[model samples]
Target: MEFHYHRTGPSPDLATIEQAIAQLDPAVLVDADDFARVRISTVLDEYALLDCLWRAGVQVAMGELERQPSVCCGGCGG
Candidate 1:
């Protein structure tokens, strides 16, 4: 959930990035660490995600961290 973007240059739009993140999230498993990283995107990647998570008292499962695949099966679980 580490985020990195140019500070001096045109920055990654926070809302856009967050919306993109939301669109990507299937079940909103945004752990505290990930959420903190989003909240602190300007300083993300520079600091460890786990550290942010720890400070925010959040937990995450390794497997659940990755983006879920797009469903082309029309919710049929194909």
Candidate 2:
């Protein structure tokens, strides 16, 4: 529905991202496959996904990443 973002740094208390994100771009890349473990499914519901994030001690707002193509597509950009 709506887009929201929050930033968390080395120290969780000092992390703030909502002010920085007025509008979210689904195509935006948060990390470059570095300094991170695991990833989110693009097609998942934003709210439900946030629940998992909270259980893992992570905070999220709204909006979700774009869909990722499955590896079986033979690179056709499916």
Candidate 3:
């Protein structure tokens, strides 16, 4: 799954966000666009991902959470 975080005000700490995501072992920070968005790939479900973010104090709007198409080779059923 890919997570896109939209910033509405002051930018949150990227390092902190990275750390938070790291807690979910399989989650990886695939890419990020300055402070406007973040793209993370993970095996964890959306609920788990969102809970982790919330617990770490990452505030994301309801609409900001998006599901992106996976860039897979279609060999592993990812």
Best by TM-score: 3
Candidate 3 CA-lDDT value: 0.70
Q: Taking the tens digit of each residue's C-alpha lDDT, what string does model 1 give over 32-74?
A: 2333333322223323443443444334333323333333455
TM-scores of the models, in the order given: 0.26, 0.35, 0.72
Clashes of each: 1, 1, 0
Candidates arranged by lDDT, highest first: 3, 2, 1
**Best by lDDT, which number?**
3
Q: Residue 71's C-alpha lDDT in candidate 3?
A: 72
Residue 58 lDDT, candidate 2, scale 0-100: 58
Better of 1 and 2 by lDDT: 2
Identify the runs in model 3 with alpha carbons over 4 angstroms from their true place. 74-78
**1-78: candidate 3 lDDT, tens digit per residue:** 666766667666666766777877545675567767777677776787777677768777556688788777789755
lDDT of 2 by residue, 1-78 (tens): 222233445423211222122123243223223343323333335655465445546565444333344544447553
Q: If candidate 1 were superposed on the true structure by all CA atoms, what would the RMSD be?
A: 13.2
Any residue pairs clashing in model 3, and if so which? none
